[model samples]
Target: MSSASLKRLAVAVVAAAGAFALAMPTASATPARDNVKDKAEVIGKGKEKEKTVPVRLLSINDLHGNLEPPTGSSGRIADETGTVVDGVGGAAYLATYVKQYKNKDTVLVAAGDLIGASPLLSAAYHDEPTVEFLDMLGLSTSSAGNHEFDEGYTELKRIMKGGCHPVDGCSPAGKWKGSKFDFIAANVLDKKNKHALAPFYLEKINGEKVAFIGLVTATTPSIVTASGIAGLKFTEEVAAANRTSKFLAKRGVKAQVVLVHEGDQVTPNQSPDACPVVPGLGSRIANGLDAEVDLVISGHSHQAYICKVNDPKGNPRVFTQGSSFGRVLTQIDFQIDKNTGDIVRSSVVADNHVVRRTVTPDAQTVAFIDLWKSRTSAVANKPIGRITADMPNTASASGEVPLGNLIADAQLEGTKTGGNAQIALMNPGGIRAGLTYAGSSAGEGDGVVTYGEAFTVQPFNNLMQVVTLTGAQLKLLLEQQWVGGPNNQAFTKILQPSSNFTYTYSTSAAWGTKVSNIKIDGQPVTDAQTIRVAANNFLVGGGDAFAAFTSGTDLWSGPLDIDAFAAYLGAHSPVAPPVANHITVIP
Candidate 1:
């Protein structure tokens, strides 16, 4: 079948192997804390004595729907000594770990990013397989990550409340049933209702009430495409969590866990169990949390660490993040006093464990993943292009990456005819993975790039947009790359320019004057010049703190970013890595 026909069929049947209906379904402590199992404890004296309920909380974050074992750097994690541990994650292996650690009082949960930016096996069906996988694994609740809003709030509601896709009806598997597990967002509120989509989810652990307050990062609005999240408001994470904690406390729910999809990045090669003090959003929120909030499980930064941060009342609290793609799981054990229904802060112990593939994989989970693979394989396996060598995401001294340059070039080519785009700038964050020349386990020949592989590299499906910006505004866009600038970026995020665009920047130059010698097609640009720029809608709308892009005029929307990339690959078969020489760095 031709590519177009295959695409139609894929959309029609979703992967076509099964005939079924759609159903929707669904922390840490030590850097190396010893095994602390959940056990009831005795408190009080004689007649007044009661058994304190012990609760075991198991968590994973930033899963990003890796039904199969992740490969490369995404699959490995650092040990206590900073040694890399490989072959760490797969859904089946993760399930085996969960089973071993779970007890009668165990509640499995996540800190958001359960879906979005997924592999082809999951993203093909709009991540329905991931939703089913979570439900099958017995997830109880989760927070909503910023990526959860990738397609917008309406689709998120559909994912939560079961329904057929408005555009593409039921998959070959039949009607979709929303998630059985709850997704709470304390900070994301509806503009009209002035209430959160779901403030919090309450779980009962052996008669003890545990409140899970889910919150997305407050900077969600600045990161996600503004259009998808139209009519929604993202408030401050710390304030929202505190407000929710106080409300739940008034209602007699004392044991609280804040699962916010925001976190800090630890040093590379940092041990997962080590608690090094880092100034991160996760640290700030954990420290600002009310004393009533006993634990904070976080995601978004995709770093794994078991850090101890003190709450507002100076009580030691555990703040953790399990590495992304199901590579790590955090086990938290705490006891609730039966008399006061409050958590014993001293009893809290948290540890991070690798989801090692050494264990026997869960039979049920293997079968489940295989089922989805069979369905998605038809479209996923089709070859789109070829590559001479791997185009990894490794950045140069100037912070430009070959993969990002290729993507920007693709975006530029994709928009030239339709939108008359003269230049394209791709955000580093938008490029998820690299293209490899070697064939994957799927049996596609080496040097062959399949549609699935391409999709994995650019999975967000952001629209390709062309907008006109004056040379001055364009200069401001480049100036926003570093700290102490108009945009106040946390770190330098040099935009990957197309092969035709070039510029120079000096780290020692004063803010706003760092960028110079801006050129498009070998011509120096003037302040009064107007240039057509091509980028994903997210960046064009000011994502990644590039607010200068919002000043562009004459907006022109084209195909989905993924489509543009795939088309570029097909047209430029036997593609090779682009040089990261477009940007010049100065001392």
Candidate 2:
């Protein structure tokens, strides 16, 4: 059938099936008991059984909706020789690489963050294009990353099951068919249902059953917006994996792999293919998992590494992460013993391959991408404002960056009318990209900032909120940036304060005493004084583990963050990077 006709048929089916048609099960969603028996096809019953069956696992993580090729630092990758290569990632090129490496025995998977924090080409349409692209590429399964909860669990369900968005309705391409791949999150329990969203997916390759168990980080609640995960519970990763592994074993399936959305950062100069011996969250989880799990695929730190960590049983297991934004693909080749239904640990060979731009682009992906680009070009290309110079997202010694300052100032300005806002705080994690003085892939002149460019920087579109907080509470909030705080962030998350708010911190000071010399509008802040502060909805709801924001009162919501940022740039044309002196750090 022609593409248009196929779309029409899909729309018709959706219309006839109603809004929840996608929620219905497909052949892939067979019941667990039946799935095990049906998929566990025992091969070679004789004593001289077949030696082994080769299986290839291809995986990617943290895609973040770069349907088109990313540019600048986001698109660059380093080869084994430590030389950097650029202009590498785009759906077209990535599809080409997947096709080159894929075979009938290959199973494709992802470690999540596939759609959130996306660029305009995908985000403008609510990431439907990305889901479609993944379907076309034949993704079998994936773990739920923290960003997957950005839009809340209900929206995530819509993304998985075919249906028009409850709020945004159907896309221009017609009804959504959800994703062909199953999104398994064994650790994320639905409070209402008391079960996992989709716990584990069992796939049979070469007559051998392999179970893929998925889990997001236990800290998911702290990183994602509180409201998005209000009805869910994130359990400890190691415990969750162990439980799932044991459950699979009971069902006569011994070959198990974990697709988790947590990872560690290797040494700065480490090559993408290097298997570092470093210890971090990923390594710790790997070391703690049940011995039945043979391989672990991870992401969320956006770093690349392939480490062989010993499990609790003192067996060496593979733990790997592919860098974010389609820059790398992790390939694992192993053999499953026909006699035992377990992986041959010695046969496991894993490597991270760069998705190079040298290959011929896939024609289908190019056409799909071009169609969306043209549809979004009008709003994406329209100039929002001009910048005098590049305002990169690079943080200063104090963890304050120019773009963060600009966003905080914008929030303060945007909320002033409705909120009597005094100071605005921007989370460093919310800033996705930098605004270059020259145009980006959206194609505009030098210094021109397009709507698409601004969208890329603040992709969350969180509502701007102004809340009332006492000076004492504000101080506690600042102190929460340390390591032992509620956030549990490994590094200090120095909040980017508006220009009017200034403070000094000492690295050597005790946790609660690190921040001092606080002032707003040139006046010393007194503990008893009440202040109206502006922040995104995520912040006010205690996202990124800033639980202190939850104590604020008299909340006032304003425009979307991206709109506020665009308006700020327009009002202040020829905008230059702000000075990095707002935050002071001392040894």
Candidate 3:
């Protein structure tokens, strides 16, 4: 299909999807947390003897819609053993545990990325199938993630509404048969109205008042397209949570927990069997917390660990982020008190269970998943194509990687109006999974790329859009990689470009001034000529605050990066590039 036609298809689907898929729940009609009593809507002013009022708090993050098991990372990680972790993640297996443990007092929660930036199995149907599956899994509430903005607030609203249908877009909200989980976005305020899209939510568990405050990281604007979130204001996560806590307090609720799409850094010595102090982005939020919050469930950067964390304030706060891809279930069982309308006290327990698909899919949950999986089976199980070899998402410990190169090439080639530009830039974060090579060792053109492999790298369904930029604009694009200020203490994974283009820079250079030596096809990168560039529409629109790139000319209408790569791989299926990958990050 022509790029223009694909662009039209993308636009029409978005708008049409908006109408049905993006529909939001009116306050009163939104489904209550699953298993909470239907008629016991409002609790009485006072109820005592709330001893042992156990509320099974179940949390999952970065599910990324891997309905099947996922291959995990191997290496040294924050306070955690970094090694080749086993490939043990699958929603089917996750379903088994969740369903097996279902009871009257359980509350299942997801921090975010429950949708968006997902495998073709789920993203293919615009993530509705995943939503359907989540509904079956009993998702009581979910926070927003940066990837949620990948498709914009509109489509997210659709996934929540059950689908964007009448066409193949979204399924009807009614198809959910009345699920009360609210897609909460406490920090996401309306730019026009200066109000929130959806604020703090209260879930009455065991007749005890519990509130969930959902917020993505404050850095959302710098990572997602401003246009998609144009009318919304993403305030600071801490401030937003604080604001919501006050509101919940006013509503006569006390026990509260934060469901964040961020993680933190921890030491390898935190635990012997497990990383006691989990490390990195999302998990770190609990390091400094304040307020009467009891627990926090964090995610977004896909890693796993547990700790008796303290919130922004010095009070005790137990936070956990189960690794993404159904690798583990972070469990924090709580003891509630109805009289106090809060958690009088709490204890924590966490384990990263391997979601082995080989295990018998739980009977009831599998039945639920089976029904929907069957409905979505047409695409869910359909092979996009196959690989003759293994593809690993490995960037050697030194950070250079062939997988990154292959994807960059795919995007560069896929987006072109059919020219030989010899340049493709890919953000490392987009590469989702590693494809397993068929043979044990690597040699020759022994491995191949599959449709699944392509999907893993460019899973967001972000279309590959080509643009034109001057040397200055290209330089600006390269410079936006570091984030925050040079001296800023905030931790971040610098943006990795998808192409072979390399830049020499001083890691010691001040932030915002770090990139230099722009090169193309192995020569000094220049500013005098116009260079054709490729990126997901999000990045093209200044997503990640790369306003300079968005300033360039849109050379041609784009196709979802994954689809483009899929077509590219399909036309030339077994794409096993030379093992000596192109990415070279020099300090």
Candidate that would win on TM-score: 2
RMSD per prediction, one decimal?
Answer: 10.5, 6.7, 9.2
lDDT of 1 by residue, 331-364 (tens): 9999989888888988989888988898999999
What digit string (tens of lDDT, one per residue) describes model 3 on residues 508-539?
67766666777777777677878888777666
lDDT of 3: 0.61
Q: What C-alpha lDDT, on a 0 to 100 scale, does residue 226 get in candidate 2?
A: 79
Could you tell me the lDDT of residue 274 within candidate 1?
Answer: 75
List lDDT for all candidates, in order.
0.82, 0.83, 0.61
* Candidate 1, number of clashes: 20
In the range 17-47, model 2's lDDT, one tens digit per residue, is 1222122123333222222212233355662
Work out the TM-score per prediction: 0.91, 0.91, 0.79
The clash tally of candidate 3 reads 57
